[model samples]
Target: MIKYFVMGLRGFFLLAAKIWSFVCYCFKRQARTVIQHQTVRYEVIQLSPLSKHRLSMLKRKTLVLDLDETLIHSHHDGVLKPTVKPGTPPDFVLKVNIDRHPVRFFVHKRPHVDYFLEIVSQWYDLVVFTASMEIYGAAVADKLDNNKGILRRRYYRQHCHLAEGSYTKDLCDICSDLSSIFILDNSPVAYRNYQDNAIPIRSWFSDPTDTALLCLLPMLDALRFCNDVRSVLSRNLHLHRT
Candidate 1:
């Protein structure tokens, strides 16, 4: 009788395990279908439009912007295209000492970056955080600044923590209030440790027609009024992909 009871209990457990696996498999299938549909149809879509009623002014939040791919893309050997206007600064070269050898890299600033920086500086503290080496990042930042003094701070690769062989930008290192701080990065991996506080952007390579920065103005404007940035970001963050 005891053996029969034990066998009955084992069968029940096996059935439960099978049921659980089937449920998980179905959920995964549905999630994949949803993600694939979003990728193709809504890749450049905007977040839910912010209501005018929610635009209550609050304490200024911290906006951390990534350098490479987010604001600019640089390469060691890419040829610089001729500037549309003679005085316009399209691309510049930075010489840095790496491994005791001087290396020169070409940097191309994203279109409308200057205007974006000027506008955002009024709403939040602007921080340029890059995974690139400080030697190169600082020079590029300096050129962008051009004594306008818009960028509030700068952080480099040494500031990032390595997690599972990928560089993660831990927001806790900089801000005590994670709710009020938001990071805009082109690489999702950089913000995997803090997805809710991140707004992943598409990586830019030298596309003259790119208008991503301009499109973000409305979202950024809405975010300035929120008491906690995560509340707004959580709704919008999932829409973007690296």
Candidate 2:
């Protein structure tokens, strides 16, 4: 009889322990769910839009582009020669001078750049900013102008102070309104200074075969619709703010 009583006591203790463990597990799961819900609610509240007009204006105007690797390909082999096709006029050569040395000018338009620029020019004022020398930069700018009519203003190497590197940020000083400015460059270093005013894009080398330019159209469209930086931030504040 004593042996049977001891066995019963052992079974009752095991059952009580199991019930206590289950209660603790339920409380932990509920706490995790509450934390997850709070995080989602905070994210939703941060991204709300500021205004319709600012959004519309940002969608309409201004694109500042980096010139060298972004627009033209600089080859390590040698300066590129302009290609002319059969049945063309013998004198139909593209002439461009860089640092007083006459270099052949070639139009290596990216696969959708012509079409993308045509659509964007209808809305945004386009500018070119490059660390390249004035002569070479102008040559590329001229080509863009002749082909797409999109290069309205150009900032060459001379416009920037090389020693400080931070001078690149000075581009913002020229803008009357920070909301209207946008920059696209391959250098993360340069874009870091203008994170508030610029959008960094990967360099598109000048191979007629490459097709990355098409991906930029939607980004341009987004900028065209963005009127104020505040609106973009308001919608993405959780992601953008430090």
Candidate 3:
């Protein structure tokens, strides 16, 4: 009887030790998270424009962008459609003989795209990600080369899987790091996958004129702010190697 009682006591002690160890581990993890969250939050608040004369600097080194329907409008029909409000240019169609079949075409460029991209290029490293086949994406890249600069790389549809009109989780898995990375796209569905690090722009198909710059400006400003804060933190923390 005494032996059985001693074994029961040992078992209880072992179980209690495990529970204590788990609780300590959990508390330590939570404390670390709280510290990180507070640090970031405090830095952000302190860097408010009104509170400081200089903007926070960031170490952002990469900028990824979407090609089709984002940088420029390209439809499967191969027509240049224009985006205009009512009382603007009415829709028209043109016929082209392809394999002896007459095909209609309609499309146009977004306004201000040239100016917006020109300014944005000066600020960040740009890469294009597109779900379109490489052949088609390359053609669009060639056309935008003048304004957006040479696309460093193009990610095609093959890089991601399609399911029910949406790409699988592989897209986000590919761009896991949010540090200094931004994706600009018009498709809300596609952008949803990377909303945490991506900027979603509205489709400007009907009015091909460049109006997106106005909306994009605020986000750029916010990015600049984040950059400034990151710079200060890095310096104070001695994060620079050189």
Candidate 4:
């Protein structure tokens, strides 16, 4: 009777093992079927624009701006700005003492300059490197900044290297990091020292309908992402100047 009982117990264990194996096999087969019929889909999601505080988190490139002819056109009392209207007032007047003589200048801002500065300031740390005198550049810079404090720094004529009777900007004096620095000037000679980093803008001389500054937005926007500005400014600017 004891031997028969042991045989029955062995049979019962075998049957339970078979049932467990069958259950596992069914589960695996069902999973395989589900995977085979699985449908994959992709969707693009749009995000909101970054805030000024958020923009600060990003490592920005340095953009050096030229003062005269590039951003604004200023003429002294001795020379008449041919484009100026008979009765139209200048944007602002600047008077500075030079050589023991006080000189007055009529200043006109380039079209869309305010909007351009507002946008670029968000992407780059703007710096003014003008060939103009310190007293004059500082006053104009103040007008451009308009208390927004967007311009990070300023470099004047004294800071420039005198070359061939012309003042050319040395970007190294402003920022030594060549890879991330850009010089936006109307004059080629100003950026002759750093051709790779130069962004040649048209000479602005009181053209109200001028869209040059606006056209540069797309290029400037695209450049902030690059590790080296020369990689794109040198190659892609020709393709997308429109």
- The C-alpha TM-scores of every prediction are 0.70, 0.58, 0.54, 0.72
For this target, which candidate reaches the highest TM-score against the unseen true structure? 4
lDDT of 1 by residue, 1-242 (tens): 99999999999999999999999999998886565334111132333545433543355688999998889877763346632333444478788888898787767888778777877887788888888889888898898888988774898999999888988888888898988898999888888877889887888977666778878887887677777887878876556552
Each model's RMSD to truth, in Å?
17.2, 18.4, 20.1, 25.8
Give the Cα RMSD of candidate 3: 20.1
lDDT score at residue 152, model 3, on the 0-100 scale: 59
Off by over 4 Å in 1: 1-57, 78-90, 240-242
Clashes of each: 0, 11, 24, 0
Cα displacement (Å) at residue 186, model 3: 1.7
Q: List runs of model 3 lying over 4 Å from the truth.
A: 1-57, 76-107, 147-149, 168-176, 208-210, 227-242
Residue 22 error, candidate 2, Å: 69
Alpha carbon deviation, residue 67, candidate 2 (Å): 1.3
Regions more than 4 Å wrong, model 2: 1-60, 76-100, 105-107, 147-149, 164-169, 206-209, 230-242
Greater TM-score among 1 and 2 belongs to: 1
Expressed as tens digits, the lDDT of each residue in 39-79 for candidate 4 is 42222123246644454554679999998888998888777
Worst 10 residues of 2 by lDDT: 39-48
Error of 2 at 100 (Å): 4.1
The per-residue C-alpha lDDT of model 4 at residue 229 equals 84
- Rank order by TM-score, top first? 4, 1, 2, 3
Supply candidate 2's per-residue lDDT for 81: 53
Model 3 Cα lDDT, one tens digit per residue, 1-242: 99999999999999999999999999998886565334111112334576244432445445667765666654434434434343444233334455666555333455555555565665566677788656566556666665445465667778867778785323344445555666677665664544555565666665433467545754564565464323322332221111
